[model samples]
Target: MSKNLVIIGSGGDARETLEAVEAANQAGTADYKVLGFIVEARYGTPGALVSGLPILGDFDWFAGRAGEVVAVGAVGSPVLRYRLVERAARYNIEFGNVIHPGAVISSSVRLGWGVIVEAGCVLTSQVRLGDHTHVNLACSISHDTVLDDFATLSPGVHLAGRVRLGEGCFMGIGSVVIEGKQVGKWSVIGAGSVVIRDIPDRVTAVGVPTKIISSQPPANWITQSGEK
Candidate 1:
């Protein structure tokens, strides 16, 4: 029988996870098939099957499967994921990681559960991705970089070696982080910004050489560039 996998959550992270799964299936390296998805209570959209994968149930269904089902967290916010993980632990449910076929990750790289490395992403030697992290399209994460849980790299974002992104951070599209920079938790690096130093926590920053402009954080951070 083919390996069976189930994903939890149906938000943006879940959709991206589904897309990555399809990409892997297309490459013929997918060892498992998505059985269904389980969202939070009062959150699931019935028949909102992504790519034909049905919405099976809610958190209750996560532990509903016997030993065969591999549950994965596909949530974006670190705080949100932390809650999910904590709740899942009550059922003793473990999670799985999704690594896309097009991503070039070194053998030395270490990853925790529910970490999604998307298409065309590169993780050089000794890179570390914490649980539930999301590295999106075409981003380059150089050697020894570490991204904590719920940290997101938007499409085309580039990180030089030894960079450390704290939990729940968001790097906008086409942004560049120079070597050894440390980005704080819940921070946002705006689109097309160039980060050259340490960024503090819970702040919204942007610009050519990224500057912290506002004392209050934005609702979201995003960039839509197409290249390095």
Candidate 2:
């Protein structure tokens, strides 16, 4: 029997996750039947269709319907993603994951609930992805890398062996993190940057050899654990 699944968000990331789940369902690797999306009240109208799927309702729609549907957070904003997960958890809603059929994942990899590994992603041995982590298109995560909760890796990002990405960290497109480097909580690595050393919390770094341009928190940033 296929479980009813809902994706929270209606943007590009949400559509990507929907595709991955659709592929998984077609490949018989997963038993999820995607029901639709739950867009925020501000972004969409309930009962409207998006990508052929209905927009069920806003976040509050799940409040009293826990355990009846499995949900996956599809937003790329780490803070917003955690907020949805934590909120849904209060109602005992079960979480689901999405992995594209084309992804290469090692047997030793451990993925937490609601993790999304998109097509062409390569996750090497002993990789640990925390809850709601998003590994975008063609990203490569080498051996023993750990991505804490709500970490978001953009398209074509590469992480060398034993790297640790802190909670809610965002690695932009085409960025590279050398071996054993640690990226701090809520930090943002700009596109095409190369991280050679550790980065501290709540900063934005950029350039070929990444430099911390600002120590300020990202706009609308919240902790990965949903702490204010």
Candidate 3:
């Protein structure tokens, strides 16, 4: 029997994950039946349509559906994603992976729960992606790289071999990290930056050869309104 899945957002990312699940179902590679979404009630009314699927309820809706329905976060913000996962944990919610059919992932790669590998992504051998990592479209992660939990790789980013990304790091679109460098936890690499050296925690870096512009903490991934 197919496992019922609940996507935990109703935005574009949620739609993309839904498409990946549908593709997996069509390819007969994974047994998943998408039941609908769990949007924060402010987004829409319960039972209303999102990406052609009904909005089932909010974060608390999964409490009664344990074991019968699994969840995967479609939101991009690491902090918010972490918060949602923690909330779900109170009810013993189980999470699943949403890998796009167009993406290429090696058998040797280790993926954690609620991981989302979007379309056109190529993950090479020995890549260890941690729980709730969000890899956006057309990115390339080379061999032996480790991405810790809640890391977000924006579209068209490239990582050379042996790179290590700490927990909750965000690499903006078209960014490139060279071989063997480490990006510390909760750091944000701005768009199109080329990282050639190590970046410390809780700062925003940007430039051709990425430089630490300020020592400020990362912008709140979760806004007051709870949107990414």
lDDT per residue (tens digit) for residues 114-210 in model 1: 7888889988999999977888889999999999977888889999999999988888889999999999887889989999989998787899888
Residue-level lDDT of model 3, residues 1-228, one tens digit each, is: 889999988888889889888887787767898999987778868999987889998777887878888899888777777777777777888999988888999999999999999889999999999999999999999999999999999999999999999988999999999999999988899999999999998788999999999774445544444434
Which predicted model would earn the best lDDT? 2
* Per-residue lDDT over 1-228 for candidate 2, one digit per residue giving the tens place of the 0 to 100 score: 889999989999999899899899899989898889987788999998889999999878887787689999999888778787777777788888899999999999999998999999999999999999999999999999999999999999999999999988999999999999999998999999999999998899999899999985454545432444
| Model 1 steric clash pairs | none
Local distance difference test, per candidate?
0.80, 0.91, 0.89
lDDT of 1 at 73: 75
TM-score of 1: 0.84
- Winner on TM-score (1 vs 2): 2
What is the clash count for each candidate, in the order shown? Answer: 0, 0, 0
- From the highest TM-score down, the ranking of the candidates is 2, 3, 1
Would you estimate the TM-scores of all the predictions?
0.84, 0.94, 0.93
Model 1 lDDT, residue 178, Cα: 96
